[model samples]
Target chain A: MTALMIINMRNILSVIMLGGIYSLISAILFVVLDAVDVAFTEAAVGAGISTVLFLSAFAITGKHHDLKRRNHFPALLAVLVMGAGLMYSTLDMPAWGDAEAPVHQHVAPRYLEDSYAEVGVPNIVTSVLASYRGFDTLGEVTVVFTALIAVLLLLGAIREDEDQS
Target chain B: MKKNPILRETSHVLIPVILLFALYVQFHGDYGPGGGFQAGVIFASGIILYVLLHGIKKTEKIISLQTTKLLAALGLLIYCAVGVAGMLLGGLFLEYNVLAADPVAGQHWGILFIELGVGITVASVILAVFYAFAKFEK
Candidate 1:
């Protein structure tokens, strides 16, 4: 519904605002799913900072810009095929929260039961993220660090070079 | 945006609370639903709010670009240093079992410091990103 509304909207600013609302609604959906941590992140990031960033970028780029029309049939077909394939594939998976699901059968049980005793943290998610999977988290943090470097190079550093030239 | 008194006053009131909430989320992750990543983004959003209401020029006076860059690197280094510490302490890389008198305590210490590193890097990197985007305005 909101996606359709956004697609039909012609104003870039309104579109961005509606996208932020979509993010907020998804964050609320995460909350409804009992993923408080994920909801917190989605609300803070997707709803809050990201919206601000997008608005700022839009402002910097231009105001009162027109949407450019382009070829859409190929893209539309590709999206429909991908969507159908994904939906068809999901029909073979186990139901939500099934005990025999691959995700629940693996390390999750161990983390759920023993993480508190082993890691001395009541929150199993944090224990798993920081201790049992420390290497993975280290890699993730490195990725975040690397993203800053990339953005700085493209926007911050390159801009300076052009300014001087 | 800066010219609006309501925006300025509200942000002034809200920024401190947001930062405090971030710290709470960071330290209380062991017992709660939040951790470094969430807390870090929340913290950066506080600074972004300041920049929004007060303008980037004034915001930079308090948190210089160099400071954010340095903090980002420092955070990455802190995480690496913890891993290296594990090695030097007769454990494998990032093995928390050797960091304290007991394995559990070592785990606690290791996770705390590791999350700290993650929080620092995430917050600074986010601020740096906002700065980059804001710079394009003028």
Candidate 2:
């Protein structure tokens, strides 16, 4: 019982500390990649909002585990089968960050070089998003708006009821 | 009514500057790091500050719900119009070069129009969403 308690404490500490550390690192990485917009979003959503949301969820649902007997046989089998197929396919993938790879040689260069001349944006990513691939940005904005609407719908009715009381 | 003239004056004064900056960013996107999305957020932030300091009702008076909704729809329409212009000029949907007689300048104009559309849409939608959330909240 004592060992299990110690292990659980360690796990909780590691989860909190490691999650914070990784989030910080990822935020810096985003900055380094010149994705200030994405970096702002990551810092806001991941570091601030997500941490608070997780804590709130934990408060609503107690820390204690229910210890349900999760039937994992089918899940395990499926994962294993998928893992084997993935491993087989890995042979075809170009090595990570290979400069000579087709991905590096293709239209990506044109987007980077021509983005300024064509789109007139200093930030190539922004140019790609707002100009070159604006349709995708429009779709993404719609998705975010839809999500906001859905959340409002879920919580809005409760506010009205409480006001009536 | 507890009258605070300073906060009201400051925000009212700041709104025009913020909106102007948003316009500059929207148009000047081709040359700088600031673009439609960033400009939209910045513009929305100014309005949000007004809403924060003053009541939602006061903010609503300045930008009505109907107006915001119309602006959001208008932004999308502007984007579609640019696309249609490109198509009519014998280019693909959203193709910039075919937008004008000079293909290169046409691309520039096309991008500028598209960015403006994006900026307007994003700003209005964000403000509208904020309004939807804050309006009914006690």
Candidate 3:
């Protein structure tokens, strides 16, 4: 176990800093994967809005967390089994960033090379999202719309008495 | 309603740049690392800034929660209408090439309409989310 800082202030700062680091790392990883749209979404959602929302939630709910360690045996065992299976599968996979990987030889190359001529767009990612695999993009838009609906249903209609209170 | 002068001034300066950048992103996606979603978020963020600095109640008067809900639905309809137009043109569902008699011109028209649909949907949805959050806190 890492030694806890005696100062509570240090712990809070460290957690916020750690979250910033994780968000930064994920944004870079998304860029590397050629998912610029996903990267932008994450950067805004995770780093921007989420941080504000969390802080607001904390303000409403208070700072002290309910620290009881709920039962963990099942969760730990499940995670361990999943990790072992993933390690076994990783052995048969092509090395990271290998140009000879089957993924590189597939239709992806066609999407990369011919997407401009095929779709008449310079950004192949947008072309893919708005044209080639448009149905999937439609699904994504629906998911966002559905989330808006859910947020509305969950917390939108304000009660008058609560407002008065 | 009196607000913190610094915040109001900062947002006054900031919102235009944000909206301009969003339009730039919407148009530049054909060449750069931006598209409908990014532009939409940037645009929504500008509105959110207004709400944050000026308070939700006042912002509501300007945009209104009811209008936002209607706009959200309208955005989806816009996207679907474009797809339906493609279908009517005798291509496969979402097939853009048949929209015009000339295939190249058809692709241009199709991509333009689709991008517009995407932009509209994204902008509205982002606004709706902000509205949700603002409403919840009140």
Candidate 4:
């Protein structure tokens, strides 16, 4: 919450730093929840790589943004409305770690029961990710590939133009 | 940025260890909490650290932008090829059961290869993007 407030400030570097800290904290939260894989990913990508990437991009852009104060009431109202809606929806959600939650009752049991027999991996997450949901992982890889290609096309074009001149 | 011998020396010692840890994370994911994505990010951060300490120019000479681009494509190709190989073996696309005599063994192989592909592509693409951003000002 404090990090969100800090992010609203004008300094870009501090905002990025705070964002990284927020991610790191969330990763710790994930660890406390026994989601070690998620914590690993959040720490590596969110806190580590993204902070460096932001700094690199910042080198190309400006370090500070022009803060022009305008009417923020509409945005605040929208956020409040959305927050209220989300809160209302959460009331219907099962309590945290409830055994009879819809998710735990559904496919989780099947994965837990048969993953080792079918996929032969001790880590159920890997078995599920790489074997059971192979297509989805492929699509994720393609998305990463597309993002890289987009960045290359955007920035590499500029380099080519400069070299030609 | 001023050149500091301390920074350079520390990085020189640290980078290899970081890279080794990434490899451990990558291959050890079968039993542990990490896989390609986490390992890839860690690996890329190691390279980024090298770039920070030794300068982008020197780092680029070692791992060229062209090579990074190729690696990104090659990784994707490796993944697609594994799927195609499964198809050729008369399984559905990305179906690992037909890749070997034993279905479970085939799955293990398939997962390893695909994870390797994921790791390679992610690491290279990230490094390439970083290079593009860093080189834009030059």
Candidate 5:
């Protein structure tokens, strides 16, 4: 498995590359699920930009991690328990793409039916996010701006000296 | 690597194509799967590709870090301004119905502007973060 390879690799660069590969595969899986927008986002953000960032960070830090053999039992046990718990929780969920599912019975129908009449956009996703749910999109933009500020502060890139005021 | 003719020539061919694709993804979202977020990441990836090939300093000369930082804030401003504009037009905050003569037209305009704002912020922020990472000295 890609996750296994990524975890086992001592070379940090290889691990980072493998992480990108894992995300790329996940993006493809999204495409298979017909979540094309999500697939595009995952491919670009997860596989593309993040991989470059990882590589840049790798350039700053040295090549490889310490390769000391460590006991994996505790980590393995934790992972198994978490996976089992998650799988057990999914047992109570509705079948995949079931029309009678609570999610389908919710506001999805209204969005699918009336969004075109109201928003006039062929893409219901766009209408839902940008028109019907405009406030959320604004919040998302604010979050992106906040993230930039946080990264700049953390990286010492926030210069306070020079100002035109 | 910058001097290598193959890499240089290939980049010349690819960069514009990448940028064009980003634009397509942005404007075609009404009819397609992509929108602002994906388009922004694609745009940033193009810039990152240029940085990877050409040196960072050279790339920064074209689009400075200060500009990107400003643009990131500008994106959020644009989004808020749209919401405020909607409120001023006799509607609730972020209400697109009052944006134009027709409610549908107003929605279209609102979505377009917000997507543009989202695209700008996402692209600039990602690029700015990459610049930070690149500039950090061990």
Candidate 6:
């Protein structure tokens, strides 16, 4: 919420830095939730790479914030509605760390029981992510590859055009 | 950035440590908390730091744009090759049990290779993007 306030103030650099901080805080939250792997990713990608990417991209544009004041009521309304809807939905969800949760009941036990025997990796997250869901990880890598190609194509063409100009 | 010798020296000292940490995260992920994605981003950030401190031209001399592009593709290829190798070994795609005499060892090898592939591709692609953005002129 404080990050949102910083962003709303129209300071681009501050916004980027605050965004990094927000990611870092969320990473800490993930650690509290016992998801160290998720925390690691959140810290690396969100706080580190994203902040650098934003700053570098900002270099292409002027640094000063535009002083255009516009109505933000519609956006505020949309956010409020979405937040209310999400909160309302969460009321029906299982309590945090509940053993009787549907997710805990289904597939969790099997993974816990068989992962060591089947995959031989002590880290169940590694086994599940790399071995059990190898195809999905491959798809994700392909997606990253596609993103790189897209960036290259777009930026490379712009560079060529600039050179031609 | 070049005018600031302190920042330059500090980053020079820090980048190697960051990169070493990235490698540790990449290889030690099986036992610890990190994996390819986290390690890759950390590694790229180290390169990005180098670029920030010493202009992209110098960084390019260290790791050229063509090399980054090639590495990005090669990483993806390495991952796909692993899956195909599994198929050729008379198992379904990505089925690691057939990769060796011992299924457990095969799983380890397959995960290690795939994670390495993922780490390589992610690091190179991110570095490539950083290069593109850094190189762009208004």
lDDT of 6 by residue, B1-138 (tens): 699989988997999999999999999988899888888989999998898888888888899878888898898898999899999999999999988999999999999999999999999999998988877767
Ranking by DockQ: 5, 4, 6, 1, 3, 2
| Candidate 5: stretches off by over 4 Å | A160-165
Worst 10 residues of 5 chain A by lDDT: A156-165
Clashes per model (N, Cα, C within 3 A): 0, 2, 0, 0, 0, 0
**Tens-digit per-residue lDDT, A119-150, candidate 6:** 99888898899999999999999999999989
Q: Which portions of model 2 show Cα errors greater than 4 Å?
A: A1-28, A40-103, A116-122, A144-165, B1-17
lDDT of 5 by residue, A1-165 (tens): 899887778888889999999999999999999888888899888998888888888888876785777798998899999999999999999999888999988899999999989889998888888887887888888888888889888877766314322
Q: Going through the candidates in order, what fraction of the true interface contacts does each contain?
A: 0.85, 0.21, 0.49, 0.83, 0.94, 0.84
- Note the residue pairs that clash in candidate 2: A120-B30, A121-B30
Residues A8-114, model 1: lDDT tens digits: 78888888999999999999999898888889899998988888889888877787655687988998999999999999999999998787888888888888888
Instruction: Return the TM-score for each candidate structure.
Output: 0.93, 0.64, 0.83, 0.95, 0.95, 0.94
Where does model 3 sit among the CAPRI classes? acceptable
- Model 6 bad stretches (over 4 Å): A157-165
Query: After superposition, which runs of candidate 1 have C-alpha atoms over 4 Å from their true positions?
Result: A66-71, A158-165
Clash pairs detected, candidate 6: none
Identify the CAPRI category of the predicted complex in candidate 6: medium
DockQ computed for model 2 against the true two-chain complex using alpha carbons: 0.18
Residue runs of model 4 more than 4 Å from their true location after superposition:
A157-165
For model 6, what is the error of residue B97's alpha carbon versus the real structure, in angstroms, after optimal superposition? 0.9
Candidate 3, A155: how far from true, in Å? 1.5
For all candidates, state DockQ relative to the true structure: 0.75, 0.18, 0.49, 0.76, 0.83, 0.75
> Clashing residue pairs in candidate 3, if any?
none
